[model samples]
Target: MKKVSISLIVISQMLLGLTVSTTVSAAAKPITGVNCNGGFFVRTPDKHIHWIDEETEEHVQVYDKSDDIYAMAQCGTGVVTVFEKQIDGEQQYNAIYSPNCMNIGSEKGLSSHIYQGKEKINKIDAKDGKLEIRFVNNTYLRGETCASVSAGK
Candidate 1:
């Protein structure tokens, strides 16, 4: 069986300037080339959607930001495009758009870098636009594409 799972450690201190870094996964960032809903969490260079393929040094997912709003759900629950990574890898959580409340911040960009300041977890398939994710908590987050969502597949 594929030994995979999601884990996060978020620590906080009430003291001012004592910001404790939370152990979050990199799955919590806006889609690189395509804009989600209508927010530039990460600005796109020019009108084209660029993707840095580490393997072939290729470019472009060939996406048009004009077709934004991939997926939408009512609270901190819904499907998201998870660029999964193997265990002992960089990140593991995939962030998506949800009503960001003061208490519940499920919206993307809540953490600047998704996997920044995070250690690897138990999983496999290090890549973007691929892999599966299982949230430890009851929170809803999944790996899926916009096309499948629209088609109701």
Candidate 2:
């Protein structure tokens, strides 16, 4: 009876080790690539999005820029693109718009207006060739896009 009790304890320990190993392996999968400049966020080969400051190589997970909207809008013909970065549980944004709003003022720059306050994007609507964004504070910004929004799943 003593030998049988020891064998059962050993078997239980082995099973527990196997369960832990399986859980750790699944959680170890990393994010490969994320492309911030390509209008929509593009994923890299490693499944992680790489956010690098052009001036500084610091790994940035969230970025807010206004210039990106102008460029994407220009390419999409009157469509503006806004990007957001989640920082400390809040959303920071950079608004990009058409050439029509370019050279307006420093206060109206692509990154300025969107980051003016503590707001983050809540929903994205790319329906009927229009891109509509709803903010966390219930404000809405709408733009007409010649191209569609393709966020890679």
Candidate 3:
């Protein structure tokens, strides 16, 4: 009787563990893209403009006017920004940037170049009061007319 009781308890514990693990995994879905109804602009640290459509997922980069790109990531609404940084004399860092927070990870394989393809932008609606900007492959900034501010008028 003791052996049978121990076995049943162990089995129950195993099943509970499996259920908890499955629930946690299912709760956290990987972010792969964004959807926006208005354009969001990204101005790199070196002053370059990247515009993305509201309803489409697009790649963004941190670059300078001299055409040197430091990092790249895909951005859109409802998606966290995954940034890959490869700057000289600095350790490479890759992570996800949320609207008001950043979660850094050491995952490898981050691209630093814009995908070679035709870029598209559709003015579905006039720019709303909010402007979304992803910077340095590390930060996501949102504000009204923030893109123009970063544009260095």
Which candidate has the top score in lDDT?
2
Q: Which scores greater on TM-score, model 1 or model 3?
A: 3
Alpha-carbon lDDT, every model: 0.29, 0.42, 0.35
Model 3 RMSD, rounded to 1 decimal: 14.0
Q: Model 3 scores what on Cα lDDT?
A: 0.35
Q: What order do candidates take by TM-score, descending? A: 2, 3, 1
Q: Which ten residues in a row have the lowest lDDT in candidate 2?
A: 63-72
Residue 24 accuracy (lDDT) in model 1? 31
lDDT of 2 by residue, 1-153 (tens): 999999999999999999998776644222222223332222233333323444555443322332222112322223244544566876545544332323221234332232233456666555455766677788876656523332212
Q: For each candidate, give its TM-score against the true structure.
A: 0.21, 0.31, 0.26
Model 3's TM-score against the true structure: 0.26
Candidate 1 shows a clash count of 10
The candidate with the higher lDDT, 1 or 2, is 2
Positional deviation of residue 5's Cα in model 2 after best superposition, in angstroms: 17
Top TM-score prediction, candidate number:
2
